[model samples]
Target: MTDRLTIRRPDDWHLHLRDGEMLKAVLPETTRHFARAIIMPNLVPPVVTAADAADYRDRIMWAKPKNSDFKPLMTLYLTEDTEVRDVRAAAEIGLIHALKLYPAGATTNSQSGVRDFKKVTRVLETMAQIGLPLCVHGEVTNPEVDIFDREAAFIERVLDPIRREIPELRVVMEHITTKDGVDYVAGGGDTIAGTITVHHLVINRNHILAGGIRPHYYCLPVAKREEHRIALRAAATSGDPTFFLGTDSAPHTDAAKLQPCGCAGCFTAPNGLSILAQVFEEDGALDRLEGFVSEYGPRFYRLPLNDGTVTLEKGPPVEYPAQIETGDGPVTVFDPGMPLYWRVVD
Candidate 1:
């Protein structure tokens, strides 16, 4: 058994709450545990414009479980033609907490993403001027590039250039997967930060292929080798503000996931914190868990930390439900399927 401890209420630095009924269903789990979440903008049509972002924010607020203060910090989806004006106005209105950069064809609805990073140079300049952070998908999509190599290649080809051009930009390299990514974010000056997912910290590519195709474990910026997973663990628990938590807890229906060619995502919001605490405990970094989960992201984003605290006790393992019923079909939330030692206490 493990001892109990209290930590500042953690914020989920990355999350995807799909729209409408799906949104209403999974949102409560996230709000119950996290104080705030940086909401992803990769909806079907995407939330590229400020109007779209504002409209979506209203929906999230409306869908939120009654009396819950789970603040959904919105992000603008970047497109090739995303205007500098929209970027500034969104941030200025306090509608967009950050701007998301998804290279076209990189992930799910990211087909509407930006085709050329350089083309958005003007918009980036304005973002630098306004102090809005750029949260990136961080993967390249050239057909010839190996799926495993996309993220590393992107760091060299796209991200480095953006870093040079927008020197003042506060960027979060979303869902980092490899040693190179860990090195870049950890080594870069204070302005560079990255969100590491629970899957990345706990499992690797082999774990996905471990018995058979484990579609639920799959996600874009796909898991890397065991070595990278180790590097990710080091980065996550290193007690660095540049390294923090972002579950990237994206969900897809079970039928969609179990099909011949399943969708990319993991519905982890429900068990995200318990799994995180388990990872930190395994790394013998429970003392450092509080910083990664609760402190660093807010400090880097310049937001005030929540005054509330949550206590997760070392008790009986949690049994996460294997599937959830959705409007179209059942959806599978990512379940590591073990005795989860750390569970949230009421």
Candidate 2:
């Protein structure tokens, strides 16, 4: 049996590092293994302006662990009022890597998301011209659409139209959770790609509903059925350039998660790589792990691949902390519900 594996350090194509105390607590979990992450812009006010993105980037840099080479690839939260000139300027200065689209009331702090897509036409056209990718939440907020069907519905009613209008615009369907999402990206050309989260790969809806509603397993774009999980694993391990890792490792205090209407996100940053190693090994696709995690994401973003290497050594099952303390409160780490024998040694 293979005992050791080393590959180029990975980059998280999608991530959420909230501001202040929470940022400090969670930043290290990602930086320890990932060289860079495309930071989410779903803050309370949201990072809408280039100036807002710059300020948030600075805060992330300050909150990042000392001497950590963790680069935060910032993104702007797209709203109806987003301006074309600002989008171009943000890309010109490298202050923003992509524009995030959150359908109004879609997820946490997304009340300010785009409501009138028509208002952002100039912005989208400009993005197409400049080659700035759009990272989308990929869900519809209509009350009539079943929560489980929102993703597929959004693709049919929303994404397809947008792509038809702007064929050159690159789009990264962030944290895709369904077989519909997988097939959509697989059939698309080079202008589109999808990111699959580690939690979704391991847990299905049953993990949350079957056992009396485990709150930590609850997240937006909630996990789908076992068939979807199987499809996600197939895409992740298939060495297809269209799919990559983007652990939407959103951290909410246990108090927030356990509330009447809890926040939506899973804290998987701490043990994401470990869990991924386990997933790939079980599928007998160990050789493709590096390509999924390290290679495909950078390729989609058109950024250079990371130079550093991380080694995972297989041995006895490793233990991960149940919760990480922050100034706000304790955030629960994702529990894979099984032993994790593959661990990052460096």
Candidate 3:
């Protein structure tokens, strides 16, 4: 049996490296394995302008480990007042890679997100003209829509209309958790793609709510039903260029996560690659793992493939820390529940 595999170093198409202490703690987990990542923009105040993006990028750089060549592709948070000129300038200078769309109140720290899509038509048009992608947290905040149905609702009510209006606009639907999401991106032509998180592919709603509420498994665009999980697994392992890896490795302190109104996210960065390797191997798609993790993301972003390589060696069940300590507190690493037999040996 094949025991070892190597591929181009991976890139995280969607990631959340929160500022300050959290950033310092989690940055290395990703940089150790990934060559680059498209950093999320939904900070407390949010990275709303070119200046805000620049400042946040600087902080990320400072937090990065010494001599690590990991590149942080920054993004700006899209709000109603986001200026077209600022986005154009950010794109032109390579200061930002994309702009994130969070329907206001849709998730954590999204209070400043867009309430009316009409207000951002000029910005969207400018993005389409300039070829900058819009990375979206694909969920609707409408109270009436069931949490499980939000992603499907978003495609029909929000994403489809936006894409139809601006056909040239490139979009990366970040951390998609539903079959509806997979089907939409599969049918969406080259202009659109989707990012599936490692956690979603491994755990379904049962992992979160079956016996009790497991807060760490709890994440925004929260895990859906088992059938949807099967669909996500098929799409991810299919080696389709329209889908790729974006471990929305959001880290929240155990204190912050285990509360009455706990925050939404999974700290998957620490064990992300190992879990991915296990998942791919279990599906008999070992040959396609590299394409999912390292190849398709850069091709869609129009970035060069990474020169270096990382190798995974299969073995007995690998052990990873249940929680990683940070200045803030202990952040729980994602537990895929199933024992992983692959480890990044290199």
Q: Give the winner by lDDT.
A: 2
In model 2, the runs with Cα more than 4 Å from the true position are none
Give the Cα RMSD of candidate 1.
1.2
- Which stretch of 10 consecutive residues in model 2 shows the poorest summed lDDT? 113-122
TM-score of 2: 0.99
Give candidate 2's total backbone clashes: 0
TM-scores of the candidates are 0.97, 0.99, 0.99
Tens-place lDDT per residue, model 2, 1-346, is 9999999999998999999999989899999999999999999888999999999999999988889988999999999989888889889988899999999999999999888888988899899999999999999999999999999999998998999999999999999999999999999899999999999999999999994989999999988899999999999999999999999999999999999999999999999999999999999999999999999999889899999999999999999999999999999999999999999999
Considering only N, C-alpha and C atoms within 3 Å, which residue pairs clash in candidate 1?
Answer: none
lDDT value, residue 207 of candidate 3:
92
The superposed Cα distance between candidate 3 and the true structure at residue 36, in angstroms, equals 0.5
Badly placed stretches (over 4 Å) of model 3 are: none
**Any residue pairs clashing in model 2, and if so which?**
none
State the TM-score for model 1.
0.97
lDDT of 3 at 254: 96
